[model samples]
Target: EEEKEGLDKEEEAAKSGAADGSGEDGGGGKQEVLDKAKGLNWKTGNPKELKATAAALIEFCKEHNLDIPDDAKQARMNVGRLVLSMKGSSALEIVEEAIKKYGIVAAKAAKAEQREAAAEAMCGHPGNAQLLLAFQELAQLYFKEGNRNAG
Candidate 1:
C-alpha cells in the first residue's frame, strides 16, 4: 500500500539521518530508541529487556537535555523492582500483582483533592477551577476508556 511505502521511506530516511548525524537534536536516534521501546516483548515479562529499555529511555532523556517526567521515573523504578523480583512470570501476572499490591487505580481515584488543588492553582477563579477539574476528570475517563488522545 502507499501508506506502507511512505512509512518505509520515512524509516530509511531516519536510518540515514542517524548515520549522517544530520537529524535535528538527534531526532532520528530518538525515533530509533522509541522504536526499540515499542518492540519490547511485554507479554513474556523479560525483565532484562524492560530494564534495558528503561535505562535507554533515561539516558536518552538526559542526552537530549530533557527532564525525566515523574511518571517515567516511577516507571523506571517499577521496572527495576520487577527485574529484581521476577521469577519467570508473564507480564500480565506481574501487572495483576502490582494492581493488588499498589492499588494503582484506587490511588488515582483517591487523588481527587490533589487534582482539585492543581486545577485551582492553574486557575484562580473558583468557578473556572471547578470547570477545569471537571474537564480533567472527563479526560481521565476518556483515557481509561481507551481513547488515549482524548485530552
Candidate 2:
C-alpha cells in the first residue's frame, strides 16, 4: 500500500508541474520572450519610443531566428498603436512595409509586444539593445519631423 501511495504522489507532482506550463525545462522559446519583456526596464523610454524600438527589435529577432512569445505580440500591438497615434500615417506605412517584407505572421500589433518583451530580456546583450535603441531614435526623429511640418 505504501509503494502504491508513493507512485500516486509522483504522478500527482508530474501532473501539477505540467499544468503550470512555465517551461522550466528551458525549451520554452516563446515563454523566454514573454519573460524578457516582463523584465524590461520601462524607464528607458516613452510608450511611443518603445513601440518603435519594439518594431526594430522584432526585425532583429527574425534575422536571428528567435521566436517571439504570443503574449509579447499583444504588448507590441499596444505600443505600436501609441506610436502611430503620435506619428500618424507615415509611421503606419513603415510598419506595413516591414510586415510585408517579413510576412503577415509578423503583424505590427503582435510583433510590437513580442519585441518589447524580447528586448527587455536582451538588455544584457549590447548588440540587441543597440539595435532596439536605434529604432526608437529613428521613430523619435520621424515624430519630431511630423510635429515640425504640422507647426
- TM-scores of all models? 0.28, 0.23
Q: Show model 2 residue runs off by greater than 4 Å.
A: 1-22, 28-44, 66-151
Candidate 2: residue 27 lDDT (0-100): 30
lDDT of 2 by residue, 74-115 (tens): 646744553444453333343332322333222333434444
lDDT for position 122 in model 2: 49
- lDDT for position 40 in model 1: 37
Which candidate's TM-score is highest?
1
Which consecutive 10 residues in model 2 have the weakest lDDT in total? 18-27
Report the CA-based lDDT of candidate 2 relative to the real structure. 0.44
Give the range where candidate 1 is weakest over 10 consecutive residues by summed lDDT: 99-108
Highest lDDT: give the candidate number.
1
Candidates' C-alpha lDDT: 0.47, 0.44
